[model samples]
Every structure is written in structure tokens, then in C-alpha cells.
Target: MTTRRFFIKTTSLASAALFVKPGALHFKDAHIGLQLYTVRNAMGKDPAGTLAKVASIGYNSVEGATYTGTENFYGLDAKSFAALLKQNGLIMPSSHYRLGEDQENGKDLMGTILHDWDKAVDDAKTAGIKYMVCAWLSPAERGNADHYKLLAERLNKAGETCAKAGIQLCYHNHDFEFTQDNGQLPYDILLSHADKNLVKFELDLYWVNKAGHDPVALFNANPGRFPLWHVKDMDNTPQHAFTEVGNGVIDFKTIFKGADKAGLKYFFVEQDITPGDPFISITKSIDYIKKNLI
Candidate 1:
């Protein structure tokens, strides 16, 4: 992983612009999606109210991040949660579910981490979700290149299961995947080994940039593999911490220009750590997207 200090000092604005191909960009009917993790604190306290606020802020879609041990969305059952989203005029096309090593303790492969995934898929179908995403990997889950290969296999199986229920499985990445293990990037390994028809990627732009890589280059390399993206930004500071979308140094305009090649279907704004009120942060981000990126 690139150190924050090095990134802040070395990342060049001119180089980022040079990476974008000159072309006219247009996103027809594309709406902004919010990753609920941005307001995890608010959602934990009041999911309904938080969603209402999100809707009012012009977010037409959402991607859930609170569907782990509960099996339910936040505190509501799948049906009720879907209803809540409808009430606010918001639709959730995707949700983040943790994927880990299947503890072979008499349980099916993914059954250990994603309890009752079949049922979760069924519920997601009912909620009108099209994608079930593996949100993150723990330090233990990603040990080396071999571990990523094994994870790709697991993802293929999971994607097959979801496909039976008309859902796609995707892996959302962080900066860690870009780090090399034995001179091979875990991201490249997964992309190479995973069944392309079954599994896809949800690229997090900020983390990719933080890792000292180019998003447009990845899109050019594996066209149509990345259908989802986390549209977060990196502050132009020593910490390179999470900040409101357009407030940071990331050139989203340059990246969005290649959305077609990236296979971008849905993108969610996610600021992992807000400088102040999260709602305020997200509002600023969406405003910027509306005026600039979208």
C-alpha cells in the first residue's frame, strides 16, 4: 500500500488529467447512489430517518452495508426494509455482505460467513436488488497470492449460486488488493482467476488512486468487468483521508469519462470517515456529482 504521506506529496494533478482520453462524456439516466456505510452511525440510530434525509438530498438509489448477522436490513426485515426505501422514493440495487473463508465446520462454503445466503438472495430478489457484493476482506482472509486465488474460486461458486436467483456477485476492493504479494497483485490475480461471467468487480476509485494506480488504465485492460464503483475521494493532505467527493484531489471527471469502458452501471458515494456531519458531507458530494461528474 502507498503510504499516505508519500501519496500526498507525490500524486500529480497534471498526470491524472493526462491519463483521461479526450472525448465527450454523457451518462444517460444515471442516478447517484449512496453507500449506506457513509451514514452508518446515523443508520444505526435511525435507519428510516436517515434514509429520508438521504432521499431529500437527491440520492435516488442506495447500496446497503448492514446485512450481516442480523439477516435483516438494519433492524427491519427484508420486506419492511424494502418498503422503507420505497416510502422514501429510493431503490437499493446492491448491498454489501461480508465474505470470509468458509470454516469447514459442517457448513456449506459461504454459509459460514454469509449465513443462509440463499434466503438472503431470495430476500434481495424481493427487495429488487440485482447485485450481492462481498464488501471487504479481513487481514487474515488475504494472506498471499494463493489466498486470493482461493478467494476467486469461492467467489465463482457464490456467483453461480446468486445467478440461479437472478443476482450477480461482485467483490468490492480496498487499497490492500493493489499491494503486491510475491510480485503479483491480488486484484490482478482475482481478475484473472475469477469466472468473468459469474463474478465482477466494484472498483473503489479513491483506494485505487491511493494505491498509486490509474483507474482508466484498469478500465482499458479489463473492459466491462467493473460494473460498480465506490465514488469516494482522497483529501489533498498528508493523511490522504476520506473527504467529500469533489472536495478532494481525485479527478472524477477524468475517470467518469471512461465509465462506458469500465462497465459502470451503478456508483455509490462513500466517505469512510467524514470530517464533520456525514449528511452534510454526502450532500456536498452529491451536489458535486450532479454539477460535474454525473
Candidate 2:
């Protein structure tokens, strides 16, 4: 980690490739990846079958949305799950976890960064996951600026744990992160206060735009800090709802132009709510990407 950090900070940017993880795919050559939450219903029904369908749709990579609840991928243990993905010709580079601070409500979320982080990291290693993302916060988790500051410290600690295991720790943001709390933007507070070497970000494009922020400007302000992205688009309507990739107003062509500057390693297409069959919607997104974005 130290060596990679030094290389990124140095003038000889040409040496970057030497630091890439073995078997890792760069942004442009990367196969289209998906956030499994986009197909949560199907995943809950049949994880193995759902992964096969996702691979059939041209998604060779995926970001996991569960693990905190069961400490396993769907019903399979870490090693078993990895075999399942391999059989389907898929890779899971990242997964999401909650804060796990809500255990008082009968939520025995033991596979969380806060609860049994080492076990989580061990399982992530076994599953061949390279990144772990703090996915989301419930309403009760949101708090004032002080709360965010505290959260930053906790994230840095979690990031250190991940680093020790050769996994990068990232935080996924929503529109609420940009909302002013205690006279300060919570997102800005995190950016300024978090340990940059320890914690990076996975920018969710739709949520960032929904919060009235420009993704490019944010990338410019914090170059190389963002390596992962959620590529969901917003519709050109009064409601500005979620839509398929090329069927919306995101201007991915423009946004993708900043991929190199943003240190992009991988991006996943996600739509929280689809009109009908999610497989059809994902097929539309991948088709658009293949035809236009690449």
C-alpha cells in the first residue's frame, strides 16, 4: 500500500501499471460490472441462477450488496460462493456492508466492519474481493456534522484493517451526504477529514447529480481519490427518476472522459427501480454501453 501510494503521488505516472493487482482489469478494458442490488429480487430468489443470467447479459464483473447479514454470499460460504462465480465466469471485486450499529433491533449483523471486521476481511480474501464499501446509512444513522467527523475516524480505522488484508476500503455516497447538517455539508466534511490513504470513495453518479453536484467538478477537486463508480442515470423528467444507461440525461460520454483523472478502476451500471423485468432493463443498459460508451 505504501509503495502504491508513493507511486501515485510521484511524477513518474508511467509506472502505475506495475502497481495494479494481478488479474485486475483497467477501466476501459473492463467488462461491464453490475451492482447486485439492482437485481436484489432475483438474487434473493436464486443467487446461482441470477449470476448465470447476469453473466449471460455480458456482465463479467459485479459488486455485492450483501454479506453483513449472513456473513456469506447469499447462502454459500465464501469459498463456495467464489466457486459459484467462477463457474459462471464472473468476478466480484467489491461488496457493501452497513455500519452494523443497529444490532439493538435484533439485527445480528456480525459480518460488518464494526462487528467482526477481521472475520469479514478473511472472508473477503477468500472470496477474492479487492474492495469493501460501506454501502448506506439508515435514517437513524444520519446525524449532525460532529457525527460525520466521528464516522470519518471510524472509516479510517476500518480502512486500515482492509489495507492490512490488501483490500481497499471505500464509502458509497447518497444525496444526503451533500445536504447541509449543522451548517456544513456532510460529504465535504468526510472528504476533508478522512484519511485519504485509508479511505477512498465510490461516487454514485445519479445520487451526486440528484444532490445538485457536478461529478466532474468533484473529480477535479479530489483527483485520484475516486476509483469506483456507480453508473446509474437519471431521467429527463420532472421527477428525475432512475433510468437505463443511454436512455437518460447523465451524459456518460462526458463523465467517462474524466475516468482517467478520477483514477477509475471499475464502474457498474445500476438502476434502483426498473419499470418491469430487471434482466430486460440490465440488457438495455449493457446494449447501450456496448453500442455507445464502451
Candidate 3:
């Protein structure tokens, strides 16, 4: 029901890459998600309109990116946001969260893992989310090998909280996580120290590849450790930038063949930056995904 006739009139209505051969695969819902940050600007302006457009573009699910500062999903409360999603025939299965830094004043910020963690989890439950990811570590936040060990502990604790809420907790990686410090990779340290039963990894395919590692080999190394993914593609340029799914160099078909091996439960199409109309780029990605990479 990805009809193109609702944005201008409905309240809830509002509103990538690559080349290569078109393959055959059915578009599957829930299995695929669009990380909302790809359209962060538009979302800031009109969450409902953007959601309608997202559904029209054929994405039935999304992973949230906003909640911390505003303590809402694009400025709407959890109940209101969830209703808007349902109105647009979309579901949000996961959301990213920040691990807030401590303040000299002794009061931590609201809407972060270290502060009002329970409230966030409660809101997530109301919004029908099943996974919560520790989004990123700021430059100052990630210092040395010991930093990762502490992070692992935090992730395990956070995972325990999420578990009680019936939600899985995951850590999203950036290329920085792979950089070796004193010959020990932070990513490796994290994977080793974090409680396996409690915390899982949300592998960012682009970043991992950017760090010069083989994802399949990583999957083989830690089977069933990855349940979520950010499926943004890397362009075939010298810069190796972001592009639409099939247009890039990533062999998604072969990568997807290892879905079961990686315990990949969900993945989202994400492009940090787009060259032209973001809508058109996403449409191109959706069309490609329809043909290949189910």
C-alpha cells in the first residue's frame, strides 16, 4: 500500500545508491528498516510528513535516531509517535541511545542511559521497539583500552535493563572502534568483555569495511553475535563514500547469504549524506532492494 497520495492532506502523512544488475528478491517488511537519521533534517521539520513519505517509498519499518535532547521522537511523545507510525503503516523496532557524560555539577542529563534509563526503556516499550542500540562514543568518551572495558561493563548493565523490558541491547560500531591501541583493538576488547548473553553488536557494515576488516570473517569469528546492522553502502570512489545499495562495491548478495550465520535479525538502508534529492536516492535504493538483497 505504498500509494503516493496522502502527504498534503493527512496529519500522519508527510512525507541512496548504486549500479549493477537487478536481481530478483521480494521486498520484506520488518526484516528491513530505514534508519531515521538519513532524513534527520526533514524529520526535524515534519516527522509525520516524512513518515508518510517513507512509507510511500516502501519502507515498512524504521530505526529511530532522536529521543535524547528532545526526549521525544521528532518532537512527538511516544504514544503520539507510535500512532503516527501505525497511521503510515510503519513500525519502529529499534532506537539509538546515548551514554551521557557526567557533569561537574553532579547531575547527569535526562534522556540518556546513565540518567533516566528506566524512562527511556518505558517509552521504548510503549513505542513497540524490540532493540535499543548504544549509538556512538564521542572523541573524549573513547580514550584508551580501559575505556572500552568500562564501556563493555556499561553495555552489559544497559543490556540487563533492556532485557527486563523485553528489549535486546546492541552496540553500534564506528571505524574508530577498530583502531588498535597498544596492539589491542577496541572492538575486540568490547566483544570479548561484554556479556554475550546480555549484549549483542549492531555491526555497521560500512564502518567495519572502512576499518579494513572482512565482515564475513568477523561473523565466522563470533557466530550469532550480531543481530542488527546498518546497511549503508560504500561507493567505489577514492573517498569510498556513501551510496545507494547496489551502486556501491559491497557484495550484499553474498553478505546476505551469511545472514543466518551472523544472526542478523534486522538491517536498515542508511546514507549519511546524499548528493541530490534524498527521496529519490531512497527510492532508488528501495527499487534496488526490491530486485536484489531481500
| lDDT value, candidate 1, whole model | 0.83
Model 2 ranges off by over 4 Å: 1-29
lDDT of 1 by residue, 1-294 (tens): 975334322322111111222552334334578999989999999999999999888787899987766677888888999899989878899998877454335644442234577877888888889989998887868889998898998889889889999999999999999999889999999999999989999999999999999999999999989989999999999999999999989999889989889888888999988978999999899888765753
Single out the weakest 10-residue window by summed lDDT for candidate 1: 12-21
Q: Tens digit of lDDT per residue, candidate 2, span 165-213?
A: 9999999999999999768999999999999889999999999999999
What lDDT score goes with residue 181 in model 3? 99
Question: Could you give candidate 3's per-residue lDDT for residues 148-181 as a string of tens digits?
Answer: 8998998899889999999998899999999999
C-alpha RMSD between model 3 and the true structure: 6.0
**Highest TM-score against the true fold, candidate:** 2
Off by over 4 Å in 1: 1-28, 102-114
What ranking emerges by lDDT with the best candidate at the front?
2, 1, 3
Give the whole-model CA lDDT for all candidates, comma-separated.
0.83, 0.85, 0.82
> How far out, in Å, is residue 69 in model 3?
2.1
Clashing pairs in 1: none
What TM-score would candidate 3 get against the native?
0.88
TM-score of each: 0.88, 0.89, 0.88
